[model samples]
Target chain A: AQSVTQPDIHITVSEGASLELRCNYSYGATPYLFWYVQSPGQGLQLLLKYFSGDTLVQGIKGFEAEFKRSQSSFNLRKPSVHWSDAAEYFCADYDSWGKLQFGAGTQVVVTP
Target chain B: SAVISQKPSRDICQRGTSLTIQCQVDSQVTMMFWYRQQPGQSLTLIATANQGSEATYESGFVIDKFPISRPNLTFSTLTVSNMSPEDSSIYLCSVERQGRDGYTFGSGTRLTVV
Candidate 1:
């Protein structure tokens, strides 16, 4: 069985500040990882995904994540965040038949 | 990528009542999934809605409680039978696109069982 862990429950960052959300996973084989953002009263939107490819994967809204196999981590990063970026971010590990095992999520609050 | 449109975006039902959430996809997909998310939490896979077959549910979830229907490749419905306060959560529908690209999710149906 595979699982994901997000260390941060909530994080507050000022506008234009760099942000990083930590995510670690426990999987036996090469795992497929993904980041998704969810706003209040809304469904989730995929930010990015990592399969077998470059270590650094770029996503929409200027977000990026690096897959570090040794660290078993795929941390999400953004150079500058806007208030609109404030939401709950989740990291998911793909299961057989492409099911997802999601983390508890990290709530991001952008302060002006 | 596939686009999902889920209906009954939100509803409040009495205990023991049932609510069926519908999901329609723009394109045919091989896998359709249902998930549950409690307030301020992550998503837990409820089941895989396979076309013309019985849905495969995850651990801690049973078919009797969360009955799913996939009449075709692009449409599915999840019914929360015998609802309870514990069943109050956001139910989301998703479809796998291109196997490895990513899963596209619907806006979610928020169910509050009082």
Candidate 2:
């Protein structure tokens, strides 16, 4: 019932170009959102989290995400993606009962 | 944020065998959790490992198949019993951060079942 959806399965961005990954959540109450990145054959690293207050949350590695409650979306954005930023991104939503549900994930490929 | 040290970074085991993964947190946490990530799939909650109580498993996950133990506030273990090829996955341990912090995860253990 409570889940996040990532419409984009894969995205290719120029090495220095801006990148945006969309995430939409379906939950009744206020949602706790988070963004995570995973490299190939590595564990997941938390990018940022949005519990309350700030609509725009900044994260590590020059990444940020804006939580749009009206749209039920928390999308991740980066000004200029580097080669090292090429990895899979996941959007997660925590429900009222403390259950965290993750989206399908988006794989971004940075090209020069 | 709490740091988690997970054991058996990678392992290959034959079918019908079992493997146990351990997670040790740097600081004591109120809530600890386990997750499973199948190849090319997102994470699925396996169970919630709370200290001094039996682990609460999610739908489709049973204690007999995936037993969990939380001996204390900073330690936990998950055992995949009677493993099959389908059980091969990357298992991760997570700790709930206090206040605004969402959660902290471990490096994860990559398991391969032959």
> Which residue pairs come into collision in candidate 2?
none
Candidate 2 lDDT, B12-109, residue by residue in tens? 99999999999999998878989999998899999999999999999899999999999999999999999999998999999987874667889999
Q: Which ten residues in a row have the lowest lDDT in candidate 2 chain A?
A: A93-102
Could you give the TM-score of chain B for each candidate, in order?
0.97, 0.98
Per-residue lDDT tens digits of candidate 1, residues A72-110?
999999999999999999998876655678999999999
Worst 10 residues of 1 chain B by lDDT: B95-104
lDDT of 1 by residue, B16-55 (tens): 9999999999998877999999876789889998887899
TM-score of chain A for each candidate? 0.96, 0.95
Give model 2's docking category.
medium
Across residues A1-112, which tens digit of lDDT does each residue of candidate 2 receive?
Answer: 6789999999999999999999999865767889999999877888999878989999999999999989999999999999999999999977656767688899999999
